[model samples]
Target: MQTRVLKYFLTVAELNNITQAAERLHITQPTLSRQIMELEKELGVKLFDREKRQMHLNKAGVLFQQRAMTMITVLDQTKNELLAVNDQLSGTINIGMVESAVSDFMMRAVQKFQEKYPDVRFNIFDGDGDTLRERLDQGLCDLVALIQPIEAAKYNYFPLPVQEKWGLIMRKDDPLAKRKAIMAHDLYQLPLVVGRRNIVRDDITDTLKIDLNKLDWRVIINLPENAKQLVLSGKYYHFGIYGVYQKYHDERLAFVPFSPTKTTGHLLAWRKNVQLTPAVEKFIQFVADQTTHKKI
Candidate 1:
């Protein structure tokens, strides 16, 4: 089957209108229609249903769409790799990173990498570790920096020198803030403000054996800034890494490291056995070296 036909099919399937897809593809309607017809005949299946001048994908088309998307992604990635091989770090690198890593390691690494390869571009997506991992697995990001280790077999993980120390963030006047180190049980008594449950909460709670249902958990925030805001209000306490905690170390907020049981490690991950281009290789080395030197 011709790749062009698959491309035409995918465009039509996405737009659900031949005219719109053709216009978007910068091809005339007749040419696009012919390509789609040829694909249908070659595949021996009707990919779409026509009803009242609208297009709806049939069951086969739905399945084919998934495969076609993967094919296109692989083809695009191949093209990029080839371009990168020409000693031009000019292509984009999509990165997903947890909130803490964004402030701690990612910022420095990206700054240095950009300085070294000014022609290279970056697309950053910041979220919790689990969300970052999900984006990495779905091919949405070229790499991910996570605070937690990824146990998935498909991913190859590199431990950064920066080990994350969990901390309890609260108002300076809060009783827990006066303590040198906060215990997990101490957090249970306060109204806990934590990031999304799936991302950081469950892992920390599981490690500490803190029952979420039994604790005075106040809010489940998804953004790092929101967690900071809540902790600064003096009513709620947030649990996060020192990197994030340090961001709000003003007079209104105080952060104490959570007792040793709560600390987690940071790691970088990408698909196993996948060949990385020179640009990505340089970035990986740069991150490794920076983290090692900073001892973060």
Candidate 2:
């Protein structure tokens, strides 16, 4: 398929409106529709379900969209690489990372990488492990910083320097906050704001072996900033990475580690056997080299 046709398909897939997509593509609506119809005919599958004024991707279309995205990313990267001369890196570095203390390594690596390849830009996407992994599988990001236990065989990974400590962030004035370390038993009946990532929560639950029903789960927070604000209310506690609170420091809050000192390693991972752009490859090596001494 032509790259332009793939671009058209992606535009329609994104907007889900023929008129909007045509306008954005600077092509006539009929021409855009004809292209999509031709694409469907070529693929021998209905790509969309249309009714009245709306159009949505069918199952086949959804599958095609994933492949189309990866294809487009590869094509774009290949073009950029071929156009570059010598060691000058000029493409974007798309890195997705979960919110945690381990992000310090990602940031530091990016800083060092940029210093070497000044023209290389970074697109940082933050989410929970699942979201980030979904983006990686869809070829939206070149690399991802994930807190383990990931499927080790799924990707090639470099260990990040820090083993992030799991803990509770609570108001300093809270009686439990005075304790040096928090116990799973200490959390019973407390108003808690936990991350929405099932893996993180599952690890904690499995480690503590506590009945989740016993805790007053106030909210399931996805955004770290929102979780930070929730803890500021003094009525809620957040189960989060230890060092994140250092950046969002509050005199009223304290980050107390778990009694048994639960910690999980972080990894910077990329899809196995996928072709990486030179910029991405360089950045990955830079990260690995920078953290060489600190790797866990």
**Would you estimate the TM-scores of all the predictions?**
0.68, 0.76
Off by over 4 Å in 2: 49-63, 81-85, 134-140, 170-179, 196-236, 244-254, 271-277, 293-296
lDDT of 2: 0.83
Give the candidate number with the greatest lDDT: 2
lDDT of each: 0.76, 0.83
The C-alpha local distance difference test score for the whole of candidate 1 amounts to 0.76
Task: Locate the minimum summed-lDDT window of 10 residues in model 1.
Answer: 99-108
Query: Which lDDT value does model 1 have at 247?
Result: 61
lDDT of 2 at 241: 79
* Pairs that clash in candidate 2: none
